[model samples]
Target chain A: MSLAKRIIPCLDVNAGRVVKGINFLGLKDAGDPVEIAKRYDEQGADEVTFLDITASSEDRGLILPIIEQVSSQVFIPLTVGGGVRQVEDIRTLLNVGADKVSINTAAILNPQLIFEASQKFGSQCIVVAIDAKRAATPSGYGVFTHGGRKETGLDAVEWALSCYQLGAGELLITSMDRDGTKSGFDLELTKKISESVGIPIIASGGVGSLQDLVDGIKLGGADAVLAASIFHYGEYTVREAKTYLRDHGVEVRL
Target chain B: MSEIVIVDYGMGNLRSVEKALQQVAPLQSIKVTSDPQLIRTADRVVFPGQGAMPDCMRELKQLGLTEVLLEVANNKPFLGICLGLQMLFEHSEEGNTHALGVFKGDVVRFNEAQLFDECGSRLKIPHMGWNQVEQSMEHPLWKSISNQSRFYFVHSYYVREKEAIASGISRYPESFTCAVARDNIFAVQFHPEKSAASGLTLLENFVQWKP
Candidate 1:
């Protein structure tokens, strides 16, 4: 009866195959993106994200075919990120059935691209992903690019506000310091950006336990939570996460 | 063996809708086109849209689809999704544009102040993700779907209208009309193609529905 908080299972795909060292029981093909996405859909995941971790531009084309296959089988909103640089990339992904495209480095490098893409493709399909790290800035966080390798010296909160004003429908805020560490999400960073934007924010990066998911919504003020390793490695199913969120009275779809 | 046409005014994701229909009715002829000839001859029509209402209306007029869509929606078994539903009304608060006036209503944006849940937490705009739809009335599309099925929704504005046409209602903070039905038309604010199994079931029912 209410708009439930979303739990998104992110698949770190590399060169057309799902990578992230996922080890699911009874999953015959671990690397298949379509099969993996379907599994998440069955687990009642609100949405599925495929972050193409492929480094090279040439290999980046590989994710297109994978998205084409997954969007056909998995009847859920599919968001594709990683290596999304130009407006052409967003168009191609949407043509192949990507429900949304997350722009990270391209957004920081050319903020106009967000405005143009959102205008052409509609802001509903445009997601601005910000990789933020703890910095000595006034907002306490700095925007990072190149998969958190380079700092842009821009205050994360200010950048988030600009992205929204630039017509970004949603923001995918990731904590670089907490990512892969499994400690927890940067609740402070997430809250700052969430409060700054009128649009929805997805708290990403560090999610060690189900409590982290609830905290992202309850404490961090995120509309949704995204995680990789936890769901990838079968440590927790998306269903388990939603159930846990429901137990915590977060109003999940479960 | 019937032809199902998806009216594409060059806005949202039509491929997903086509793919979803192909999955449900593999043998059925489904075409995505802006050409009125293709749409006019089709047995069914799916009006799918996203983006600003002004853009959608401008495109529909540019393509000369305003009358064609009105004709089809009146006679054929028409299905509208998201902006498609909004455009069926008289006007939209989005872009402050005039719509088709197929139904007696207006599209309004969610109030920022009234978006708090019972827990007092503020709800996000666009109202993205899965939300439970409470069926307000019985229809052919609700043949196999349950009463309170979760559907994938992503929108900022909703329809404000009389209760006579409201078929399904979902809540962000309070109950709002999320679906409308009258005669041959069935419009929804949620994307059934992206609503998982229950959504597929609804589409299948639509494909098999004789009415």
Candidate 2:
């Protein structure tokens, strides 16, 4: 059988708790990270990613305890991201049980951090997260840092290509415009990046319904689709998403 | 309840394997250690692998668990996952590194040009995701699990071995060895912990297996 398209439930963590919100604003507490992860594992999530939104001023090490707790309870591929500034963070996360770590601001600050991280820990465990917003210019997307507060003037597609060449195994591209819109995924942005890179592209942001997930793979050509609200708010279960995708001939593991 | 020691040579996270074993067989005691002495006495041994072959071998040797690992694998009910399955082989093309030589073969990387599907769509490497596994031979590990059940996989290299020795098989572009079984040893390329229900069921069977 062909490798099935993956469905990942992203857990946004802050101050040792999993948090969620619309468009990365107005944060609301979900449940314990471990409990939520276990529930998603039982729900047949292909993988789980935790993004720590804790402010850097507070010691970032707070996420380690949460990682151990979640890794102990959930038996699946787990990825942790948000404030990974150095290679030690990657080592610490993987040591405690995270399969991979996503680096955004750090990668932007020091592009070589991507190459160095991949060298220390194989590329499979290094995921470069690019937060891209529509550039003011007509056609391309620009990279944003500090949680989409500042524009880096880097083209999303071009930056993604550079990340791939730097040994980043996977690219998690989030469309700031489409995030939390509950409208649909940024198919054009995802498709453009997916077509340019040889490595897998995980399309994230804006998944309101099952069809949105389906269109992500079929139209956007994403290797995996990451969603938050639909699964977190009880809008739909992971099984429901997989079953819907399978029924639509998308080949999800059902 | 029995002791299940997961040999961790510091290659990657052994927590998933240890936690999954706990989930599937809650009564059993699971330990993740590189202590050779503990491995020799464990009721069941899990050899979990991750990262690259060169680094994995370096740690396994540097930690001096090779003898104990071989001893348990030969007599104990040993289960290997992903890199664990690859490490048992003689060598890997990843870094031109020599393996434990538990199984006679080589682990080679997937050639991209040869990965075209029937429709000419190129499949990605690392084979990352879930896919249906076809059982090539009967085995107790498949107990309560369907024949063509989907399992999670994430790897760029694969083991090349005789189909006769393979307990299960799956394909991506083409067929390569996805599972191997012989006597007390059963190894798979896919992750049971991440495979959901059928995966948990297989782990449950392994815990109860008597070799």
Candidate 3:
């Protein structure tokens, strides 16, 4: 039998600590990433993903010590993203014990980079991240890159399909419009891309309650669900999320 | 003082297992040990695993644990979790790996297409979460546990037993075996340590169970 569903808590690292904000405004420091990750691991999170929101803009390498500290503390899988533009960056992340490396703006600029990285480290090691926002001009959503600063005018659903074809083993799709709003996930957006791709899809953004997570999986058709504010500010824990999912008939690691 | 020896094969979640067992039994009685002699002398043993099945089985053989594990399975209470449960199967489709052959049949990955059809919904891979189990109440390990309670699970592959060895089953897009038991050997695909109160109670029952 296949394993149950997983509850994942995402941490956005700006300057070595967890931070959260609506529409990326009024950034507030949550806590140390390592400490927060350890708590989630203790609460039974299947895995944790860390996004260095400022690493690319700052032109600095990944915070290796932080990654090392967290990896040593938690036994579950860890995924690192942001400022990961080249194959060497992926190598560095993996060497630091990150189970997977997620690429966003860099992969958009060089689509073939996905194929090359997958070939070097295997497909399972590569994750393609797509940030999307609703566009008024086209009356639909388009892909956004570079921390949601650049709009590609490309359809979000189509971009996901292309990323998979380019050898991305997994996809992390975050809705910029819905992010931090806590209204609920963009189920329509998640469903569109999920239906078009075969690889694992991690639905992110606008998660206010446990029902949002279950709705994302059952209605949006996502494989895994990722939340930031709910987990970061202690609105609920990984254990509570899993229990809620279990009660709702959604499979999750208890 | 009944002692429970958790085999440390240098892979997977070791601390969580230790913590869960401690919550169920006395912390003094649960010891995470890599020493084969300690495991052989323990009243019960737990084999926990993550990652690929072949690598884990190889490490067990390299540490000369195959014979020790078989002896424990034959004479003592043996519990397997996740990849630990897969290792007890005959073989695994992952990397074409061969298992301990303790239970007949092979471990295989979930066919996503088939699962979607069965559940009428898109199913994700690497199933992770707290899920409900359809279990037989007669099993000692499940004593006092109701049918509505859930357990934590994280795995991508499952066992396909030749004959019925399962004592409990869970539905995830499709019905699948969640727990298996035969003779003195018992295994659960879910992680009791991660599962919270219901899971902790299951472990406590196992600690006090006398077959």
Which number leads on lDDT? 1
Model 3 per-residue lDDT tens digits across residues A84-145? 88998887787666767899989988999999887666566688988998874342779997
- Could you give the DockQ of candidate 3? 0.14
Predicted candidate 3 versus true structure: per-residue lDDT over B1-211, tens digit per residue: 8799999886654656776676566655888888999999999998887666767888898888989887898888888888888898889999899889889988998886765734666655555455678885368888888875667665678888887788888776678787899888889998776565667778788787676
A1-254 per-residue lDDT for model 2 (tens digits): 57888999998888886777422112243456776787788778989999888886376778898888877777678889988888988888988879889999899889999999987778888999998888963348889887678998888989998999998989999999888899999999999888888788899988889999999998898999999899888878899999999999888776
DockQ of 2: 0.61
Model 2: CA > 4 A from native = A21-30, A136-139
Please list the residue runs of candidate 3 whose C-alpha ends up more than 4 Å from where it truly belongs after superposition.
A1-129, A133-145, A150-171, A181-184, A207-219, A230-254, B1-3, B23-26, B29-34, B117-119
**Candidate 1 iRMS, in Å?**
1.1
Candidate 1 residue B192 Cα shift, in angstroms, is 0.4
Give model 2's docking category: medium
lDDT of each: 0.91, 0.86, 0.78
Per-candidate Cα RMSD to the true structure, in Å, reads: 1.1, 3.2, 6.3
Give the per-residue lDDT of model 1 (tens digit) for A32-70.
Answer: 888888888889888999999998888989999998998
Ordering by TM-score: 1, 2, 3
Arranged by DockQ with the best first, the candidates are 1, 2, 3
Among all windows of 10 consecutive residues in model 3 chain B, the one with the lowest summed lDDT is: B117-126
Looking at model 1, the pairs that clash are: none
Which pairs of residues clash in candidate 2, taking residues 3 or more apart in a chain or in different chains?
A: none
Per-residue CA lDDT of candidate 2, range B93-127, in tens?
Answer: 99999988888888999997787666555577767
